[model samples]
Target: MKRINRLYIKSIFSALVISLLSCSDDFLTKEPKGVVVADLLNTPKGVDNLLIGAYSLLDGAGSSNGFPSYAYPASIRNWVWDCASDDAYKGTTLGDFATGGEVERYEALPTNQLIEQKWYVMYDGVSRANDVLKALAKAKVNMSEANVNVLSAQARFLRGFFHFRLQQMHFQIPYITEDVADPALVKNDHPVWDEVETDLQFAIDNLPESFPGEPGRATKWAAMAAKAHVHLFQKEFPAAKILLDAIIASGKFALVDNFRDNYTASTENNKESVFEIQSAVNDGTSQGFNGNPDSWTTNPYNRFLPTCCGMYQPSQDLVNAFKVDKDGLPLLGIGGPKYNDTNLKNDMGINSADNFVPDTHLLDPRLDWTVGRRGIPYLDWGINTGNEWVRDQVNGGPYIPIKQMFTKAAQKDASHTTFARATAINYRLYRYAHILLWRAECAIEENDLPKAMQLINQVRKRASDDFVMGKVNTYAFPSSVTIDVDYTKPAANYLLGEYKTFPSQAYAREALQMELRLETAMEGNRFFDLVRWEKDAEVLTKFVENDSKFRVFMKGAQYKKGVNDHWPIPQSQIDIQKGVLIQDPAF
Candidate 1:
């Protein structure tokens, strides 16, 4: 059956007619002047209005609301880190989550509220798209035919986007198509994976190529990127590799030398970013409340912003993850007094008991680009959180050494008057570095070690002490494995006064995941990465149990059975479908 897509729109009211109409009996032959619902939507301009409504889908005012809808939920539902509350399901056990102050219980399929919101937002977008599709079938809009194609493509992207979200959250969902289709047929409880794949593939086929002006909407590359990701999750490895390879070979997307540029508002579409929700600075037309000082807690300034939310603190485990040099030497182990922690304290004008101190020999080029140590001055090109310290973890009030503060105050530049407010650092969604890593992942799975190593080196080469990139020339450190010092004792260790190997990929992957955790930290992709790699639950548990502050913080958390595995779908949905919709086994 051709996939069913439909939407319902209605107006309700009570009305009465005036007796003055009696005089109109003489004019009975004249055509009626009252507005008719169907007729109001049949004109050329009517189609234009409908198309405008379709475009609104991208802004997220409609059902498929951006960020908090799919992206936030996906990130929040998996294991990342605890911020304000220990009740985070993705961050803690469901049992412990219930005992905590946080609201959502993502583990229980029938009980969790996230699933309800997820299902609703998706269908809302689907219904709107359906309405536009139905209206276009009957009305020939006055605009050029090319515009019609673009409009149609946008609508399809929205529909496909919503469906894809449903597929991600719930493995099986009813596929909705055009407005004229039967509702019962469209609401089938167990739609096959192939059906959903086809919809995404269709969207990939119909979307426009990436152009100068199209920021928020899905482009051909975005669709293809989504497809590659979906196929990877589906375990269609070779197919995904082929598509990703094509995009990588296109040379259209290159790695930005300074990692910070990827997140700034003005520097968007900078070689990276396969697909992202386009955000702007103070443009009244955008959906995100971008400059809202109240919600700026997670803003780039939060790390540096003195007034914002400094809750998403990076763990020492994460801090020690960066490679000292690209040759793979670790920055933390065996190197005594990595950097004069005192220098970092002076630079940021703050003190950090647990701040990362890099080894002198292996201070990788990206080290300065990654974490904000104690004494380092806030550079315009890197993360601006003032100093290495994070304050209290429980309440947002006090500053404790164990829980050092990562606020915006660290990024303040005396030269720029507005440094206290906005920092233009861009959020990296998909960097060439990640693409290289992803390609390496596929190669590893395929047992193509040589190919994997080559791709890995391509990323490593950028961080080489050779400094061929010129832009980051000064920060690049040597990548040679010269020292293999053992760091077994605390007194002799660099961190604990111990000395060890100067540089290795053992630390590379650790640093990579750690940076990915901190860099993308609260952006909502952390938990997903862990689960996809089958390590979220295990790794998080290990970190929490071993770390004193984390243990104390997670003390009352409830770790229920299977809470670590998958989230439970909300029960309300299954009620609508009777027995057709089975709740996930544990739920």
Candidate 2:
């Protein structure tokens, strides 16, 4: 409702490339980049771009001028804010995001720019989705029942998602429907999950399982997944179990064979993808707005993108999470809070050209796929030498995030060289593994430890089969981790084994929770998951201290319970809404 674009900023909505061309020469061709056409509101193309515009903001980048780096606070990836947990650092320069210690620590305030940016993006997405619905209502004259159902369903699904994202961040939020006369007047009075659920249910009732040619479009199963994901946050185990069971029963999704497949652009919309926010490049626009502009700052600094600013480096605590026992089971088994006590060897102050050996600790194979440790192969981008790929090893740490990056070969079409962190990579919002783990949570609650073990094992089985490997031409690890010159061997001392039994409900819960962390680590789910499980205060308080030992910038950081669970409503929005909106309690 309080749009940054309509006021200080120009256009927050993405530029829908609408072409109105005659069969004549270049004079007849008029391609409007940012403005929505008033005349084409009833035409099919206008409605289509409005729909696409709703989908576009999922990446948190927009405008016809140029690409906004995905590292910004609004990115669906949640890299900056989610770092408030233990998974990663704000990285790059210490004062980066220019937030000081706001996000990385719990020093954030109502006036933080990141908070305002993220709030507006979510609301912008809601506004765009409403636009599609209102336009469709007026234009339904030329549409069939089936077409309208699918199109309207998609808009509702997006509207549900944008509000759901808002709910995840704040304690109170307003759910704006198309019927609302003035969204600014809408009160953040009661909980919006019921409204969110209704929208998603409509999507499930009308959406198809697949869109035939459109892989990015939301399907019925994807809608179910979205609702089930919210159910987890609400701790609605029975309701969540029902939805997840129906999805698995549908047999519509499964994990991709290789763990690496989930990260690369080539394997997007694979078997595991439940719902992916689509991005593209090189479709004739001067700027690649359709690509992942959000990724610009989360990668290794400058080695790939010449102007790359990302250093969303993995934490030493997160690295220690991969520690496995002799049998390859996690060493931090069954809620040992000291899981991060022993860190794998790192190259903190070491130079790039210096000799550094890869850590020989027995680790889950997913670690290599998730993190870019010193001596490991970072996808197809060659062996990661400490400090070379990172901007400041002292502040950002010795590792970079690998899961959010692309394989070297995938970068050709996946990226455009012009300010090219805008990758064509599809952001996997929900994967099949997520449903399995969500169900595992239900199984744990029911004291069905065996069922939980079985579900958790299904995910680990996939991890053990896939290990990161250096490319044929890349440098090899120090023989301790590799056997051949082509780097045919697994990159790290990778070992992922299945659990035989859960032993008890407590152990099963801890194991299941840890599995979720190992699986989704650097993808920006850590902080919220900690909060969802009510472990944010304990984990994050200790996290800042533990993380502070290495990342000096977080030395005095703290996470206060009740207060830090949700970010404060941005002061800007509250003022704009007058008395209609109130800030979250205590901050």
Candidate RMSDs in Å, in order, are: 12.2, 6.5
Off by over 4 Å in 1: 1-115, 140-149, 179-192, 284-295, 300-307, 323-374, 378-391, 395-431, 463-522, 547-549, 556-563, 575-580
TM per candidate: 0.64, 0.89
Q: How much is the lDDT of residue 312 in candidate 2? A: 69
Assess each prediction's global lDDT (C-alpha) against the native: 0.43, 0.75
Q: Which numbered prediction scores highest in TM-score against the true structure?
A: 2
What lDDT does model 2 reach? Answer: 0.75
Off by over 4 Å in 2: 1-39, 63-71, 303-307, 333-337, 470-486
Clashing pairs for predicted structure model 2, backbone only? 70-293, 70-294, 297-310
Give model 1's TM-score versus the native structure.
0.64
Per-residue lDDT tens digits for candidate 2, residues 101-152, read 5777788899987787777677767777777787788788889988888989
Residue-wise lDDT of candidate 1 within 213-323, one digit each (tens)? 645456667666766766756667788787778778888787666545554444556666776443222222132222211122332222333433342333344444432
Residue 154 displacement (Å), model 1 = 2.9
Tell how far residue 228 is off in model 1, in angstroms. Answer: 0.2
Q: Largest lDDT belongs to which candidate?
A: 2
Error of 2 at 341 (Å): 1.8
